[model samples]
Target: MFEACLDRGLTLKKVLDALKDLISEACSNVNSAGISLQSMNPSHVSLVQLNLRSDGFKIYRCDRNLAIGVNVASLYKIVRCAGNEDTVTLCVRDKADCLFLTFETESEYKVSDYVMKLMDLDVEQLCIPERDYSCVVRMPSKEFARICRHMTQIGDAVMITCVEGGVSFSASGKLGTGNIKLSQNSSVHEDEAVIVEINKPVQLIFALHYLNVFTRATPLSKTVWLSMSADIPLVVEYNIKDMGHIKYFLPPKIDEDSS
Candidate 1:
C-alpha cells in the first residue's frame, strides 16, 4: 500500500487537472517522483513522463516502485466527486485497486469504492531513451497559451520553427497563417505578450492537440522550456519545482518530398 499527503489542497487539484488533460483512457503508470500515461488518446502521440516534485511533494516512502495502470477516465471521475479545493490523500491498495480520500473537519470521504466499473489495466514499464536537442526556448506560460488559442484558428497543425534567436509558433491552412514569436528574454512573470529571435531556423510540424496537451501545465508554471532540433521530436518542459518537472515530447512529421 502507498499513501501521501499535502499541506495545501489546491496543489492536488492543479496536479489532477493537469494529469486529466493528458492521461489516457487506456493505462497509466505512477512511480517515485513521477506519473506517466501512455497511448490514452492516439497511437502516434503519447506522454511518458510527468514529475510531481515541482508541486512540493515527493515520495515519502515506497515499498516498491508501484505501477498502477488504470482507466484515466475512471480516476478522473473519482477525483471530480471528491470535490475541489479539499486536502487529498491518495493510496494504492495492491495492484488491483486504488483509493482517494479527502479530509475535512474530523471526517474523511472515501471516494474510490464508489467507482463501480473498475478497469483492470495492465501496466507496462517503459524506459524512454534520452536524445540530444539543438534548440531550447523559454517563455511565459500565458503567452504560450495565447499563441495556441490564436493558432487554432488557422489549421490542425502548428509549425514550430526554432533557431538560436528563439522559437516561432505558426499555423497556416485554407483560412490563412497565424504566428507567435517567443524570445528567451520574454518574462515568464506578469507579461502576457512576447516575441523573440533565433540564430538558425529549424522548422517542424506538430499536431495542435499534442501541443495543447503539453502546454496545459504552463499556467501552473512561471515559464515553459522547449527543446527541439531539425526533423526530430520536440521536448517541452516545465520545472514545477526544484525536484520535479513535466517533460512532453512530440515526434516530428516526415516530409516525403524532402526525404
Candidate 2:
C-alpha cells in the first residue's frame, strides 16, 4: 500500500501539465524516501527527472517499493476537475491494478474521487554519472522562459555563452540575428538575481525547440538553475520549494551553427 497527499491540488495539476508535452506516460517509483520519475522524451533528444520527498507531502506512507505506470495526459485531465485549493491524495492498494485519486475541500463540503487504470511499462533506470559543470547560472525562471521563447522565434538554435559575470543568448536565421545579454545582479533577492559561477568560459549551441519545451516547467519555481560543460548535457533544474526538484537534461548541438 502506498499513499501520498499534497496540500494543494493545483501543485499536482501543474506538474502534470509541465510533463504531458514531453512524456505522455511514465512510471513513478514510490518508496520510503518519496516518489521519483526519470524518463526520456519519445524522440530521445532529452531527459526529465523528478524527485518528490515524502516529507514534503502533507501525509505520506509506503508499505513497500512500487512502480506505478501512469498515462500522464489522461491523469492531468482528471486532476483538472479538482479545485485548485482542494487537497489531493494519490492512493494505491496492494495487488491493485488501478490508482485512486481523491480531492477534498478545506471545509469538507466537497469531495471527489477518481480511479485511473495503471499500465505495465518497461522502463529502465539510467545511471547518470556525477560531474562538475564549467558554468552554473541561477536566474529567474520567468526570465529563462522568456529568453527561450524569444530565441526560438528568431532561430531554431541558440548559442549560449557564459563569461565571467554575464551570459548571452544569440540566434541567427534567415530573418535576422538577435542577441540578449544578462549581467549578474547582486542587489536583488537571491531568487530574483542573475548569478553566474564559472570555472572557465564556455560557449555551446542547443536546439531552441527543446529549450522551449523545458520552459514549460517555469511555473514550478521562481528560479531556475542552469549547469553546462563542454561535451555534456545541459542541466536545467527547478526546485519545487520544499518538495523536491525537476531537472531536464538536453545535449548540445554539435558541429552546427545557431541557425
Which candidate achieves the best lDDT against the true structure? 2
| Cα-based lDDT at residue 49, candidate 1 | 61
The ten-residue window of minimal lDDT in model 2 covers 250-259
Model 1, range 182-217, lDDT digits (tens) per residue?
A: 665544343443334344567888888778777667
TM-score of decoy 2: 0.98
The sequence of per-residue lDDT tens digits that candidate 2 reaches over residues 92-209 is 9998599999999999899999999999999998988988899999999999999999988789999999999999999999999999999988799987899999999999999998
For model 2, state the Cα shift of residue 77 in Å: 0.6
